[model samples]
Target: MSGGEGGEEESLEFTPTWVVAAVCFFIIAISFAVERCIHYGGKLLKKKHQRPLFEALQKVKEELMLLGFISLMLTVLQGTLSKMCISEKFVTNMLPCSISDKHKEESAGNNTATMEHLGGLRRLLSESALSQTAYCASKNKVPFLSIEALHHLHVFIFVLAVVHVSFSVLTVLFGGARIRQWKKWEDAIVQQINDTDPSLGHAVTPIHDHAFIKDHFGGIGVHSSILALMHSFCKQFYGAVTKADYLALRLGFIMTHCKSNPKFNFHKYMMRALEDDFKRVVGISWYLWVFVIVFLLVNVNGWHIYFYMAFIPFILLLAIGTKLEHIISELAHEVVEKHVAIEGDLVVKPSDQHFWFSRPQFALILIHFILFQNAFEIGFFFWIWVQYGFHSCILGKVKYILPRLIIGVFVQVLCSYSTLPLYAIVTQMGTNFKKSIFDEHVQAGILGWRAKVKKKHTLKGSLTKPGSSSTDGSTVRIQLGGITQKDAGEIQPVHD
Candidate 1:
């Protein structure tokens, strides 16, 4: 009877290897083709003036990343299901041996004999035939491949394909928005020039003719603005500014003018504001790169190692998010300072200090990190646990699920609450450093002298005027700061 049962189990365990292989091949081929199209299409759109095509490709890339993430999650679910099914089958086969022993004992009407028979049977099966039966039950017609191994490989390929598809999406959304915003700003500046001085309206040169706008407002405007803002803050702290600081201050003024103007697209205004700072923090850390590479290598080897490496990306992402918060806080502080300087009577309130974080863009980024990025990270590892058959036994299931649940809760809390503390630390450190420098300058008697000299120079420069300040037969002089006094006065503060 046992032999017949074993044969039936073996027959039922057959896995269609060719079908799985063909499906995997098709998936890989399709993923490769789609990825190639995204890559070359992005490049082609970039070279040409195909704004719509480029934007479409960028959107497609983001969607692909989302799809890849979903596919990986599904792979994990499938893996868990397969393991559970296999384990349940093993438990079912062991049940018959126990049932037969109970029947024999009941017929004999002896409890001790029944117990002895049960023990003997169990021992015999465990010591000899259990391995053979399990091997047979697990085996399929796929040469040396067992059903478990085949399932694992198929899930692995599916995950790989998803990952490839995700990374093929490019981050080009910000570029197109930037160009459109600049063109609008140029038009606004040209209109302002024509409105301010009607006599030279016919001779008012194009926006590109303005050297300051062309040099600073071209492509690297955000970068220039950040550097300029940082310099201005440094100058305010330390009365005597360096050449670098002065240039940065000039850039900051230009950025503020562009940002404060009502004619420009505020949504696309400061898209790349914190991008450079993010790159600076993440790129300079060589050890993080090494960790990333090592984790990838381990992930490719097998599920066991991949399980540990899975959380590394989440941790790195959280770190990046925290750094971004810090950058935003710094930006907010600088913006408030600029406002206070421009509107001399305006006071900086505690609420104004946190204004940047409340902005639509910052809020959107925060929501994405919490709702999308963190959730994806948690789902990914949850899938990993389920996929590797770690949840089969009671002990294994507890070991796999319990710690990860706790970790996930902890990670969520950290990502959400830790941003403010990190931001505070960064700001506090800068404040302390600036205070210390100011104290040193005061003690050396250089602070007061420098302030007086700057004040006197400003007064003299404002009163002085050049006679030949004309461009293209237009008497409307383009100030070195990218805006005349009247234009500056007309500029409004950005509400968002």
Candidate 2:
């Protein structure tokens, strides 16, 4: 009967209990092969100067990192599963062949009973491995994570991995596209400026020096072509080298101009605002980046899941706030411009327009909201660090996710409730956009950018003077920025 039972047990364990080890090894082998091929392939194509190959190398690195991340998750899942399904407390459960009996057997030099005990253990393991369905189908207490939870987490990780890979790939493709577009735009602008008569360009499209182009449109050949274009498309792509450049693409109400001063080139103010905000954001962003690197590398499953819960709101709010600013820039540019200023000397008129989004008060309100929101992000990691135990494998800690989220709500609400002398801060002073205030108050306090602020040069005896753009018979003296634009082109569209 025992022999028959042994045969049945052997039949039950048709597959190896710890086959995941072999799977891990196989995955490693495959990754290694792929990495080697990519690295070598890039080297081979270096002589041809195929720019795409460089990006491919970068993609390979990101892919390998993600693969390792996925592999680590799978390994953990497999190890826990194997333990729950096939392993048993063999030494403790050897009561039938008690320690005394084993000693006696050893003293008498009788090996038959000992061999039988070992054989029985093997059969037991085989039986357990084959009956793995029973473990999953019922409550499993062996692993820290319940079988249901483990599989659920595994599924989530799989989906997350897929999404992550897709995002990376899309970013690369989009980056390439953005590189092409940005280059094309630069070339067009250069051509337009070169072809444009300087006298006309000054009054309408200001023909600026190399410094102007360098300051504004990330001047041609100024940045590393390969590096700058790597992920130039998306400012949101955290690891992108050109994230600052992407951020610099927009300089909204930060480039505020007093409607009173025509000498105040919106383009010049635009450049200054761009530099200030870009620097401030880049400075502050490194902290978040460091946190991200640590967070990802640590990969604590419960903590990560908890983070995702809160981070979703953070990311969503960020995107929404950005969109709101863009809309405000378009619809209510005048109000924000008057309320926000870059110069210390220029006194702007109090923005009377109240209903729309261009209100200075609203801009400042949004700015503070964003500040608090960012502060919350920095605080979250610390909160997680303090509240939760870092024993990453303990899935029972997943229960804390919801409770902490509630606490976080309380934290946010409390923060909002506790009011400060914040009104003073939002009150747009002439010295608002200066560098000294950047880190202290306005970390990139850009609302949105103004496209084509047409400074209308209203001069003395302008309408009375006989000047017809249609006739082109006589030069018109429209005093602009102290420079006489002699032949003013067709009365250009003006910005109030």
Error of 1 at 245 (Å): 24
> Of the candidates shown, which would achieve the greatest TM-score relative to the real structure?
2
TM, every model: 0.31, 0.31
Cand. 1 TM to true fold: 0.31
The digit string of per-residue lDDT tens for model 2 on 109-181 reads 4356544654655445445554565564465433333343444444443443344333333333443333333
lDDT of 1: 0.38
Model 2 TM-score is 0.31
Flag clash pairs in model 1: none
Q: Which ten residues in a row have the lowest lDDT in candidate 2?
A: 446-455
Clashes of each: 0, 4
Give one digit per residue, the lDDT tens place, for model 1 in 1-496.
Answer: 2363334232223646876789899999998998998899889976774443555456556655754775666556643433332333443332212455446535764457544654543344333333444554575311132334444444543453343223222122222232233444445544654577544434334433333322323343434656544443333223221222222222343344433443433222222222211222211123432543454444422144433433543565355444444344344345443542231111112222333443323432343233333343344454454453343221133555555556555554443344322322222222111111112224235445545656766776677685533222212222221223222233332332
lDDT of all predictions: 0.38, 0.37
Task: Give me the runs in candidate 1 sitting further than 4 Å from their true place.
Answer: 1-154, 160-262, 269-293, 296-318, 331-496
